[model samples]
Target: MKKAAIFDMDGTLVANSPVHIRAFEIFCARYGVTDWREKLANGFGMGNDDIMRLVMPEEVIREKGLAALADEKEAIYREIYAPDIRPVEGLKELLERLRAAGIPCAVGSSGCKANVDFVLDSCAIRPYFDAAISGDMVSRCKPDPEIYLTAAAALGVSPADCVIFEDARAGFEAARRAGAGRIVALTTTLPREELEREPQADRIIDSFADIDDIGALLA
Candidate 1:
């Protein structure tokens, strides 16, 4: 009965969505996309490719390519976020608790591998995660369950035995589709009201600090 924990990056581990949003703004400005703001209104949970497709024209995407565009935008985000990267409240403590309980931990993120590595390394939590599945590693993104399943597999744990932590509606759906033991939504990007209205997560909390009944949540 070995169980594990899987966490999403971005709004889940750290509240870096603002920095990412800023990067997106800068990226779209350079590309002459005046409607970037409107396009990005529902973009928090999306992968870079989807963002590019949403904001950039088909010709622009064809010319710049998804990988290069993603790299450029994420580069901006990393540069902007490096100085401010810190774990959300109660993240380290929770990781320690899970580690002490002998539960393996992994990262299942929609960000690129570079973004994931940067967060983990910058936050000084790389050692806490045994595996990390990023957007570049999966063909299908969040709401598809591939990333979490891949992460769980890398950790040598079944998805049914893992508790997946998320902050976005898409991530919640992915956790549910993965058939995770538990799906805990963090009100980092979306509020509790929006998340509660969904049928994905088993529990919702503002931060890892509020995880008082870990046993109940994991059950």
Candidate 2:
């Protein structure tokens, strides 16, 4: 009957979406790609390689190499997001409560390990997480159950006993596909109304502060 909480890093635990988008824009500009804002918005929640494939031309990817381009963009992202790396409002409190309750927690994110490490370390919340599973660990991205399932395994919890906290539609669907016990939608990135329309989400809250009874919700 072990229970676990799995959180998405970017928009779910941290309010770093704008910084990520800006980093994409900067990277796009360097490569002379315009309309990056729209592309980045549409590509949100995708893995770095997927995003690069979507935005960068074949020739560019070939020239710079997929790993190289992804690394550069993530490096820029880390630099831009370093100073502002704080958890989303109420996230620390929520994590503390979960920790006190003996509920293991893990970060399951679509970001590469570097980006994930940067966020957790910068926000000083690394010690709270029992496991960290990044996009690099899985071949498929969100909307696929691989990452969540992997995280559940890493936490030594059953997928049926894990509650997933996510901010994107794809992540919600992924949790559902993983057969997670509960799916909590964070409105940090998407509006409440938008997240409400997602059938897979069991609960929707603006921030962790709104979740007054975390244990009850998990139960």
Candidate 3:
């Protein structure tokens, strides 16, 4: 079987989920969109397009040039958070283990490629990933399975033989929909109860550092 692992980018690998939340708050305020903080919590693992749809009505969006507003939000997020982006603890170790085992790994993220590239490059960990497939690369993002499927395809791995590492409920659902053989869900954004409710997760952990024997878990 083709053995591979696909990982989520933001909260799963990098420590910028909170930063993104803050940026979203600031971004929404510019357009007089109040309650963005609560909206963010509700859309915990949603993609950008979905977020936009939720925060602004289609009619209002069209009237206010929301697409341009989204671009501005992302620009602010990138400017404020990209420079400080770094990998989560034990991420390097996990990648090294996968490489030593000849298990290909790809990044399957809901963020755009530019965001992915900026964080990975800033962390100096871009060399470890075999490939990367972003939400923008697919017709649909997380909770739709397109990005995970694309990642598996890019890495020459069958979805059924791939292990997925995700931090959000949307990612967990996407991995399952993609037919991932195993899923390691990190409790980064969601609480224990919420993560446990996800039937797709094969294992749940607080972080990569919390995994006692990740290789064993994969096996």
Best model number under lDDT: 2
Query: Whole-model Cα lDDT per candidate?
Result: 0.86, 0.87, 0.81
Structural similarity to truth (TM-score) of each candidate = 0.95, 0.96, 0.92
Weakest lDDT window of 10 consecutive positions for candidate 2: 35-44
Name the TM-score of candidate 2.
0.96
Give the local distance difference test score of model 3: 0.81
Q: Deviation in angstroms for 197 in model 1?
A: 0.9
Writing each residue's lDDT as its tens digit, candidate 1 over 77-160 gives 999888878999999999988888788899999899899889998999999989988998999888789999999999987999
Q: Comparing candidate 2 with candidate 3, which one achieves the higher lDDT?
A: 2
* Candidate 3 C-alpha lDDT tens digits along 67-158: 56667777899899866777888888888877888888899998877788887888888888989887777888788998998999998878
Error of 3 at 117 (Å): 0.8
Off by over 4 Å in 3: 57-60, 64-66
